[model samples]
Target: MAEINVTPFVDVMLVLLIIFMVTAPLLASGVPVDLPDSRANPIDQQPDQVTISIDPTGTIFIGNERVETGGLPDALAAIDRGQAGNEPVIVLRGDRTLQYARVMAVMGELNRAGFSSISLVTNSSQSAP
Candidate 1:
């Protein structure tokens, strides 16, 4: 009776597991921010949606490009022009350590730019015992 070889299969599985573990975090969108925990339901991600991230220091980013608060509206307008008539969803990713006002300021800009579909991104809250 011949025994089946399991060592190579186990090695391949281990390598794949490690690869996924390393890339999972990298798959998250926009700048790295410590998102606040919330009980809100997750929203469906849109392909044409725009991500604006606010880091701990209150720096704003459109995707990976840093943009000044003053320039945000114009930047958004440019994006609007590129997308033509379709209204792009705006997702705000703010650091948990940031003051509420800072986040609101960014939101204010988005509102002034006439972006009605805005969403705040947050980490899911863990269930209590």
Candidate 2:
């Protein structure tokens, strides 16, 4: 009778698991932001969150995909239309160099598009309470 060796495979899996566990936190670094300090408390977040990023150049991104301003409303409308049951939280990440008016404009657009549960993304390292 021939038996397959399972011990070595299990050992390799264990080693990989350890490696991943050590680096997992580093991997979750969300879109970088030089967020202005706020006195408000941070909100607890779930896994079902969507991110929209605005770079220093004022370029908009939806999960790494460049989105034109003209198409932003339509894209958000699509998201709202596609919801089956649960509503996903939308998070906005804007560069600190961006003008406040521009950021507010985007937020207003999001609201107009019917995205109610929106959150602003921030760098946890720099954010205070």
Runs in model 1 lying further than 4 Å from the true structure: 1-14, 81-85, 127-129
The backbone clash count of each candidate, in order, is 0, 0
Tens digit per residue, CA lDDT, model 1, 8-126:
99999999999999998787665889998898899998888899999999999998889975788788787753455678899899999999999999999899888888999998987
Candidate 2 structure quality by residue, lDDT tens digits, 42-75:
7887777778888888877777677886888877
lDDT at 22 for candidate 1? Answer: 93
TM-score per model over all chains: 0.78, 0.67
Model 2 compared with the native: what TM-score? 0.67
User: With candidate 1 superimposed using the best TM-score fit, by how many Å does residue 69's alpha carbon deviate from the native?
Assistant: 4.8
Error of 2 at 54 (Å): 0.7
